[model samples]
Target chain A: EDQVTQSPEALRLQEGESSSLNCSYTVSGLRGLFWYRQDPGKGPEFLFTLYSAGEEKEKERLKATLTKKESFLHITAPKPEDSATYLCAVQAYGDVTSYDKVIFGPGTSLSVIP
Target chain B: DAMVIQNPRYQVTQFGKPVTLSCSQTLNHNVMYWYQQKSSQAPKLLFHYYDKDFNNEADTPDNFQSRRPNTSFCFLDIRSPGLGDAAMYLCATSRGRTSHNEQFFGPGTRLTVL
Candidate 1:
């Protein structure tokens, strides 16, 4: 069965602190890994997509790196505005079809205290 | 700006009552998805529409139905609401079937069963 797991369910970090959230997955065939940020009572916003092992993507203070079995979202000098639930999702190649299903992790809740 | 939009940011309905949540997209994407998210949990895919074809998840309940009237509009209809059905309903859209395509999410509708 395809499954995605995120560690450190909740993290409290002081402003300007650097931290990393982990997303581990077990799937048949990894097609892509995605990261999203969701604020309270709102939909998740798309962040980064990692397609292959050793691939990395960055935006401002956030960087995402991928591996064969897992991915990491690293936050650098995170601000209070960066405080949100980070979600990890994986898409797997299924049945040699055009449609691949995405499975999401439970998400990591991060709080940046000022 | 091309984006996904959902109606009724918050919805209150009585148990066993029927309710409908609407979503529209300006991105002209080929696929649309509906997901139900409970508090502190990952969003669970209920169904998706690829152009005019509807695809339902295996675990989705029969009470939950969806309709796509056109390219830009989709609706989620709950025939009978229960307390357990209270959750955030999210709408998302993507360009095509490739795993690399990023999905754009709407603000979501918070459904409250009273």
Candidate 2:
């Protein structure tokens, strides 16, 4: 069975603190990895898509990096506005002829206190 | 700006009653997805529509059904609501049926089953 596990279920940081969230997966074949940020009472917002190892993408103070077995979302100098749940999902190579289903991890809840 | 829209941010339905949640996307994306999210958990994929074709998750309940009447609108119908079925239903859209693309999501509809 394909499974995605995220570590540090919750993280609390003061303003200007930097940290990283981890997501590890066990799947047959990885097609893509995704990162999203969801605020309370709102749907998730797309952050980045990493297709291969050693790839990275950045937006504002967030950076996402991928490796063979895991992906990391690093936040630099996070502010109170950055408080939200960070989700990581993996798209595996499932049945052919159709795109694989995207499976999500439990997510990391981050709180940036000012 | 083009965006995905979900109607009735909060919905209240009685047990054994049927309820419908509506979603519309102005992005004209070829693929739309429905996800169910419980508190503090990752959103789970219930089903998705690629064009007019419907794809359901193997573990999804038969009580849940979906209809995509056109390219822009989709609805989720819960035949008989139960207390366990109360959660937030999210609507998302992608440009196509590709694994590399990021999905855009609406604010979501929170359902309360009494």
Candidate 3:
């Protein structure tokens, strides 16, 4: 069975703090790994997509790195605006029933206190 | 801008009442999906339409149903919403039902059961 898990279900960081969130997964065949940012009362916003081990992508203050069995989202100098739930999802080359199912992790809730 | 659009940013319904949530996309995508997200949890897949080919998840309840009238519009109907059904209903779209296609999401409809 394919599964995705994230560490530190909730994190409270002061403004400008730097930390990392972990996303570990077990899949039959990894096709893509995705990261999304979701705010309260809103749907998730697309962030980064990592396709292979050693692949990384970065935005303003966020960087995502992928590995064979896990992925990491590193936040650099995070601000209060960066406070949101971060979600990790994986799409694998599934069995005959479905090929495009995207499995999502429980997500990490981050609170950047000012 | 090409985007996924969901209506009724917030909805309040009585328990055991039927309600419908709607979504439309201008991205001209071939896939539309409905997800149920509770507080501090990952968005759970309810069902999806891959160009009119409806696919339901194995664990989805029978009270939930969906319809895709055209390439751009989709609807999710809950026959009898329970208090446990109060959640954020998210609508998402992808270019195609492929492993590499990333999903774009709408702001989501936050359902409140009374």
Query: Which prediction has the highest DockQ against the true structure?
Result: 1
- Consecutive 10-residue window with the lowest summed lDDT within model 1 chain B: B95-104
Candidate with the larger TM-score of 1 and 3 = 1
Give one digit per residue, the lDDT tens place, for model 3 in B1-114.
Answer: 998899999999999999999999999999899999998889999999989899999999999999999999999999999999999999999887775468899999999999
lDDT of 2 by residue, A1-114 (tens): 999999899999999999999999999999899999999999999999999999999999999999999999999999999999999989888676666768899999999999
CAPRI verdict (incorrect, acceptable, medium, high) for model 1: high
- Whole-model lDDT, model 2: 0.94
The list of candidate 2 runs beyond 4 A from truth reads none
Candidate 2 vs candidate 3: which has greater TM-score?
2
Query: Candidate 1: misplaced stretches above 4 Å?
Result: none
- Candidate 3, residue B72: lDDT: 95
**lDDT of candidate 1 at residue A29, scale 0 to 100:** 91
DockQ of each: 0.87, 0.82, 0.85
Model 2 CA lDDT for position B2: 96
Pairs of colliding residues, candidate 1: none
Per-candidate TM vs. native?
0.98, 0.97, 0.97
Highest-scoring model, TM-score:
1
Better of 2 and 3 by lDDT: 2
